[model samples]
Target: MASSSSSTKTDPSAQGQAATQQRLTEAWVRLAKQLTSSKDYQDIASLVAKTDVLALKNEKLERELQDALTAETRNLNAIQEVKNENMAMEDACRQKESQVEAAQMKESQAQSQLQKAQEEVAVLKQELDSNASKITETVNSKLEKEVQIRRLTEEMEKMAESFRQTEADLKKTNQANMGQLKMAVDATTEELNTLKALATPLKPQADKRIPSLEAIEHDV
Candidate 1:
């Protein structure tokens, strides 16, 4: 009788448990139907679509950022190259300026030397002019002395010719005077001889009367 009473009680408990399980299954089905038909479900669907579009936009923005960084790096390198080229150009300019200064200095020295050479040439020209003037004066003086010597020589020749003529005339006059003196001496000697001959005859007669004349003159 105890075994019969336990079997009857277990069969009632199992039937009640089956009823509870059936109610839980019905509630889960209602909940699932409500969720599928709600506005929240539609909002979740639209949000998922918006998230896909945002992901695509984010990928494009990341690619643009990477390209900008690459361009900036190239610009920085170009700026450095320009700076180096400017420094080299400045060095070349300084060297050119130094070369120009040296050329100017050499030109100044050449001008100074040319000026000195011109001054020396002027001095030499003045000396040459003075020498030419002295030579001209000496030539004129020599010519004047030659003219004077010629005049004196002509006068001496004229004086010598006049003296020769005067000597010839004097010699002729002396010869004529000697001839006349010889003729007069000869005439006087002949007259002296005639007078001596006449005086000899008279001397005898005068001697004979000399004594009588002397007696008569003595008586008187």
Candidate 2:
């Protein structure tokens, strides 16, 4: 009886092993059939290759996008720098225009000053000419007066010399007349003395005959 029981237990174990092996064998058979179809195998290989190619293209597109973004940033910075330079040029231009205007105003003022100076110089020249003419006229008048005085002095000297000559001629004629009158008076005195001497002699003679002569004369 113990031997028969051992045989029955052995039979159950063997049956279980047989079932597990049969299921494994069926799964293997189905896998082998699926692999053996050529169309299915080719379709799987083409699909795998297409997936790899898509992955490579996606990576390249990402790199190009990054480069484009970098270029756009650089362009923006360059545009900002140009705008700053233009603003500086505008400020410089405005400053130059203001300086030019100031210089022009100064030039105009200088021209005006020059014109005023010229007018002053002309006035001074005219005044100087007038003064010179007046001085010349005064000098001429003085010279004429001096000439007239010299002529009058010469005339006075001539008149004085003529008067002296006439006085000398009158004095000589008076001296000659006085000498003639003295000679005539001496002659007259001598004649009177002779007559007196003769009359005295005659008177003595006549005295004797006086009486007779007197008588005769009385009768005559």
lDDT of 2 by residue, 86-131 (tens): 8888888888888888888998898899889889888988887887
Please identify model 2 stretches exceeding 4 Å from their true place.
1-66, 138-220
Error of 2 at 2 (Å): 20
Please, what is the whole-model Cα lDDT of each candidate in the order they appear? Answer: 0.60, 0.57
Residue 200, candidate 1: Cα error in Å is 90
TM-score top scorer = 1
Q: After superposition, how far is residue 127 of candidate 1 from its true place, in Å?
A: 2.0
* Candidate 1 wrong stretches, greater than 4 Å: 1-66, 146-220
Residue 77, candidate 1: Cα error in Å is: 3.5
**TM-score of every prediction relative to native:** 0.42, 0.41
